[model samples]
Target: MSRLLVTGGAGFIGSNFVHHVMEHSDDEVVVLDKMTYAGNAASLEGLPESRFTFVRGDICDRELVDRLVSGVDAVVHFAAESHNDNSLANPEPFITTNLYGTFALLEAVRKHDVRYHHISTDEVYGDLELDDPEKFHETTPYKPSSPYSASKAGSDLLVRAWARSFGVRATLSNCSNNYGPRQHVEKFIPRQITNVIDGIRPKLYGQGLNVRDWIHVDDHNAAVLLILERGEIGQTYLIGANGEQDNKTVIEKILTLMGQPADAYDHVNDRPGHDMRYAIDASRLREELGWEPTYKDFDAGLAATVEWYRANEGWWRPQKAAVEAKYAAQGQ
Candidate 1:
């Protein structure tokens, strides 16, 4: 069995990917996580100890990264300071973790000749006009609008440079918005879901016209596995399920599904420099790799997500107060 090292394994997408690996494969996994506010150790609960091992550390620690890279058959790099609001408040951590940390891992993997995959976001391509029919493809030009996206874009470039200059066997995937279980309450979907649970009005940004191309975390992870196993080295793939919905519609659906009035939510000030929309064109991944999303029905997937939050209040409640308090301070 291959031994895979998953950085940021305690965080939302990383933790979901770990679960995906365990459920679908015989591969052993080593999770290296820094346990930030978004990283919840409990998310990895009940995983078999024989197949899973957790390491508490930072990816920026070059010595530690070198040691870990030397042992793994491949490295799936997922560690990053990923929140746009948090990055706007303080861009330093995003630069440090997303850029410097990625540099450190790239160096280690290059030295060890380990296979690598970099997990990134489509925000790296900036936003599209609300009326535009074009979606972001693998060939989209980089035009990041926020510190978070800029840092991620920088990290993606590093992987490319390393793959070409040092012959590091690496692949990359830029995925659209993801929603599923174990997501931190600070994110859009979970924040609204948890607010409803606490008898508070869900807050919408601006007129709630900004669009996101949603994909289930499981579908994203499934595509990642396909890319890691069969994708050509040095190629970048875009992963999306074409589940596009405006902020208004998403919140309304959530309200309706949760037994509340569709217009029950409140409108708050939008974040500065908010992108109007993000859509992904994942044709390369689909046609070349033969990968398809199981969670293609957005409404059904979203309903399932709502049910997960309703039943797992204890998992998200502890982080709700602080997240809302932070948003309140920003007038968002």
Candidate 2:
């Protein structure tokens, strides 16, 4: 059985991945998380004590990272300053965590020659025009439009360089937008879902014309596992499920699903450098690694996600007011 080190495993997608591994594999997982505002300890609750261990620590801590890296057979690097709005407000954390943290992990893995997988975002490709018929491919050129994306783009490059320069055993995957349970209220899908749950009108950015290629968090995690197992080192895979929907349509769907009027949402100021659309072409991952997303129906996934928040009010309620307050302050 493999012993895996999962950085940011307490955060949304990382936590989902931890659970996925527990449920599907014999792998023992060590979760290294900073317990930041986005990382919730409760999300990792009820994991088997024998198979799961949570380490509250920073990825930027080279000593702690080295110690952890030495004990695991593989390192799945997921820690990052992920929120675009927050990155716009403060870019320093993005640089520290996404860039420096990755460098630290790369150094540790290079020293030990451990198998490593880097988790990244499709935002590194910037955005495609709304009418553009193309999607982001593995060979797409980097054109990040925001601080968060730029920092992630920098981290991706670091992994590539480490793999080539030092011969670190590593692979990378850039996934599209993810939506599922345990997501923080600050994220787009969860923000809208929890706002409706709390009797607040959902807020949309500008005309809400920007589109995101959505995938279930479970599907994204599944792809990560497949890449880590079957993928060749020094390669990058794009993970997506072809679930694209505009913001307005998504918010309206949430409203209608929650028994509110279809038009019961507000259009607010848009954030600076908001990308118009993000689409992914995962043909390489699918064709090469035999990976495919099970959550193909977008509406079905949304309904299930809405149901999760409705049933887990205590989980999301604690962060609702503060998240909405921050957005309100930005006039978003």
Candidate 3:
């Protein structure tokens, strides 16, 4: 069985990857997570003890990273300061974690000669015009608009440089927006879902015309596994499911599926420097790796996500007040 060290494995995508690896392959997983506000230990509950282990630590810890890298056949780097709003408020953590933390992991993998995969977002390519038909691809020029995207952009460059200069066995994937079970309430989909669950009207950003290419977290992780296993080293793959929809339509879908009026949501001031659109062209991943998303229908995925929040209120409730409070403070 392949042994994997999954950084940020308690967070939404990483936890799902751990579960996916366990369920789909004969792999043992070691989860290295900092247990940030974004990472929840409970999300990783019920992993088979025989095949799974969780370590509470930061990816910035080079010694720990080296020790962990020594034991794993591969390292899937997912730890990052991911919230855009939080990054705008305080960019220090983003610089420290996204850049330096990635540096540490790269060094460890280079030293240990382990296979590595970096998870990134299409936000690194900045926004496209609402009418633009082009999507972010492997060769898209970097034009990050926010601290979060800039930091991620820098991280992706680091992986590329390490692969070429130091010959680190690494591949990278930049995925579009992801929505599914176990997502933190602060993210767009979960925020609206939890808000609706609390008898509060969902909040939409100004006009809600901004477009995002959404992909189910499971589909994203499935593609990640394919890349980690069979993708070309030093190559970049874009992971998308051709699920592009505007924010207005996504919110309305959530509301309608939740048995509420599509117009029940309220429009709030949009965040500063909000990207107008983010689209990903995953033709390389699909054609090269033969990957496909199981949740071909967005409505079906949103329905499942809504049910997850309804059934696991305890998992999201404790973080709800604080997340909304932070947003309220920002007047978002």
Candidate 4:
């Protein structure tokens, strides 16, 4: 069995990936996360201690990273400050964690001679200007608009550079937006679910026209494993459900699923430089690795997600209150 290191393994996607990897393989996982406000250890609650190990640390610590990478067969880099609004409010943490921390992990992986899998986002391609939203391909140029996406773009480049310069076997997968269980409630989908349940208005921005391809976390996790196992070294793959839904549409869908009315939403000022759309082309992943998304229908998955929140208020209430308190203190 391969011993793997998963950075940011406590966050939403990372946490889901960890569960997916463990369930599908006999691998031992070492999760390195700082447990930042976004990174909560509770996500992995009740996981068998023998199958998983949690390390409270930052990816930027080169010494710790080197030691962690030394014995692992592979490393999956998933740690990042991923919110656009927060990135706009403060970009420094995004640069430091997303870019420099990624560099540190690359250095460690290079020294250890381990395979590296870098998880990335579709935002690196920036907003889509074309009328017909063709899926974003692996060859799409990096034209990130927000500080968050820009930082991720910089990290992606570093991964490529490390492979060319140091001969580190590395693969990349940029996926569309993900929603599933254990996601931090501050995200759009979860926020909407929680708000409607708590008798508050779901907030929308900019007419909610921004389009995103939604994928369930489980499907994204499966695609990541496919890339790690069958993807060509030094190649970039794009993973998606090909399920494109706009922000407003997604909110309305949630309302319908939760049996709430559309009038319950409160439209707010748009986020500055919000990407009008993000879509991904998964043709390469499908043709090359035979990886296909199973959760293409957002309604079922979204309804399940809302139910998860309803059933696990204890899991998210503290986190939700803390995040809200932080924003309230900032007068956001």
RMSD of each: 0.6, 0.6, 0.7, 1.4
Which lDDT values do the candidates have, in the order given?
A: 0.95, 0.95, 0.94, 0.89
| TM-score comparison, 1 vs 4, better candidate | 1
Q: Model 3 segments beyond 4 Å from truth?
A: none
Give the alpha carbon lDDT tens digit for every residue of 1-332 in model 1.
99999999999999999999999999999999999898998899999999999999999999999999999999999999999988989999999999999999999999999999999999999999989989999999999999999999999999999999989999999999999999999999999988998999999999999999999999999999999999999999999999999999999999999999999999999889999999999999999999999998999999999999999988888898898898888877
Residue pairs with backbone atoms closer than 3 Å in model 4 (clashes):
none
Task: Kindly list the per-residue Cα lDDT of model 3 for residues 12-128, writing each as its tens digit.
Answer: 999999999988999999999999999998899999999999999999998999999999999999999998888888999999999999999999999999999999999999999
lDDT string for model 4 (277-308, tens) is: 88888999999899877776778888889899
TM per candidate:
0.99, 0.99, 0.99, 0.97
Question: For each predicted model, how many residue pairs clash, with residues at least 3 apart or on different chains?
Answer: 0, 0, 0, 0
Question: Could you tell me the TM-score of candidate 4?
Answer: 0.97
Off by over 4 Å in 2: none
Shift of residue 176 alpha carbon in model 1, Å: 0.3
